[model samples]
Target: MTGAPPDVSIHHLRAITNESTVELPDRVVEILAAVGPDTDVLVSDVSARSFAAATRRSYSKQEPNLVPFINSLQALGDELVLICQVEHGDELVTAVVRATDRSLVAATAIDRSVGIVHITVQELCARLRASNAPGVELALEVASQCLADDRVRIFEQGALSTARTVLTKYTMAAEKGFDVRGLDGFAGALVPLGDEQPGFCIVQADTSVGITAFTPGNADVVAAMGIGGLSLHSETTEETG
Candidate 1:
C-alpha cells in the first residue's frame, strides 16, 4: 500500500443513496502515496453487481466479454467487491489496493487499468495504516487479508438475512446506518441502512433508529431488492404500494 494516507476521508465514511454513488478511497489513499513501490497495482472491480448485470459500457474496450473475468486476488474467497468506474458515475469507485495484504492483480477496468480495490477489513486496515508503505510485505499482506476475510462471510450472510426479517413489515431502516453491497448481478446503494421500506420506518419525532447492518447477501437474487428489507418478498405484504 505504500502507506501513510488515512486522515479521515472515504469522504468521511460514505453514505450516499438515491440513484446511489460512493467513491471514498481517501483520495485513492492519497494517490497511492504519490505512487512508487514499482507500480504493479492492478485491480479493477466496478461492482455492486456490475450495475444490474454487467454493462458499464460492457466493460468497454469494444464490448464483448459479458461475464467471466475474475482471474486473481487468489480464488476470490467471497467478500468480492471491486470498483473503478468513474468515467461519469452513477457510482462505483471501489477496489482499494496497494498491497497491505497483497494478492492483487485482477484486470479489466474495461481493459487493464487495475488499481486493485475491494476494501473492508476496516477499509483494508485503514488503507494499510494510511499506507506510505506498511512494509513487511505490507504487514504480511494485511495479515493474510485479515485471515482471509470472505467479506466477513459475505457480511454475515447478509446479516442473517436481515436478522430473520426483524419483525417483518416492509421494515425499512437506518438509525445506526448499516451497509451492504451486491456486485456482478448488480446492487449497491442503500447498502447500509436506508431503503427497503415498502411500509414501516418513519420515526420522525426526532428520530432514533439503530442497528448498523443487515445483509441479505447484499441482495441480487436475480435483481430487484433495493436495500433494507424485501428480498423479493416473503411478506412485506404482496402489494407494497
Candidate 2:
C-alpha cells in the first residue's frame, strides 16, 4: 500500500432512512454488474446488519469510501442498498441512486489521507471519561492493552467514546512509527493535542477509522486495518482540557 496521491478528492452523501421495501434500481444493478471481478465490492443493507451476498473480496486492500454509498441509500426511496467499490491503484468510488425515480442522490470518490499522536493512557482515560459516551470502563481496558502491546485485536461494538479513544491512540502510535492494528465499528473526530499545531478535526463515518500517521514500513499493517491515512502533523504535547 502506498500513500494516496495528494490530489485525491473527498466526496459526501446524505444519510436518510427508508422503511419500505423496494427493488434494487436497474442503474445500481448495472453499476454493480459493470464492476470488474478484480474490483472489490461490498453491498449491505442500510442497517448494515448484514453484508449482502455481493461482498466479493477481502477487505485487505484500500479501505472502501463508504460515505456516498451509505448516504445514497436513503434517496433510493425504498429499501436502501450500499455499494462500495475499490479498484487496484484507483480512487475509491461509491454511488447510490433512487430506484423509484432513477435519480442519483449521492456519488463520491475519495482517497486515504493523514491523522495525530503520542498520548498517554492517563490522558486517554480522561478524554474517554469526558466524552460521557457509554462503556468507558471497557474502553479503558482496551486502551491499556492497546498502549502496552504492539498489536491488539478487539471484536466488539465500541461506544462512540471508545472509538474516539482508539482513533487517537492508533494515530498517535502510527506517528511514532509503531505498527498498530485491529479495531472495528466506531466513530469519532481527531482533535489535535494542543493549540500550537493547526487544529485538525475529522468527524469520521461510522465503522471507519483514519490513521493520521504512518511510515513506509508500516503501510501494510495500516492497509490491513482498512482505515484511511491522513498526513497531518502535531506535537506530543498533552491536552490540558
Per-model C-alpha lDDT, please? 0.26, 0.30
Model 2 misplaced regions, further than 4 Å? 1-91, 101-106, 114-123, 148-241
lDDT of 1 by residue, 130-156 (tens): 434212122223233343443321111
Superposed on all Cα atoms, the candidates' RMSDs to the truth, in angstroms, are: 20.3, 16.8
Best by lDDT: 2
CA lDDT for candidate 1: 0.26
Q: Which pairs, if any, clash in model 2?
A: 113-229, 113-230, 114-212, 114-229, 114-230, 114-231, 115-212, 115-230, 117-172
RMSD of 1: 20.3
Task: Please list the residue runs of candidate 1 whose C-alpha ends up more than 4 Å from where it truly belongs after superposition.
Answer: 1-69, 75-90, 100-205, 218-241
**What's the TM for model 2?**
0.28
Best by TM-score: 2
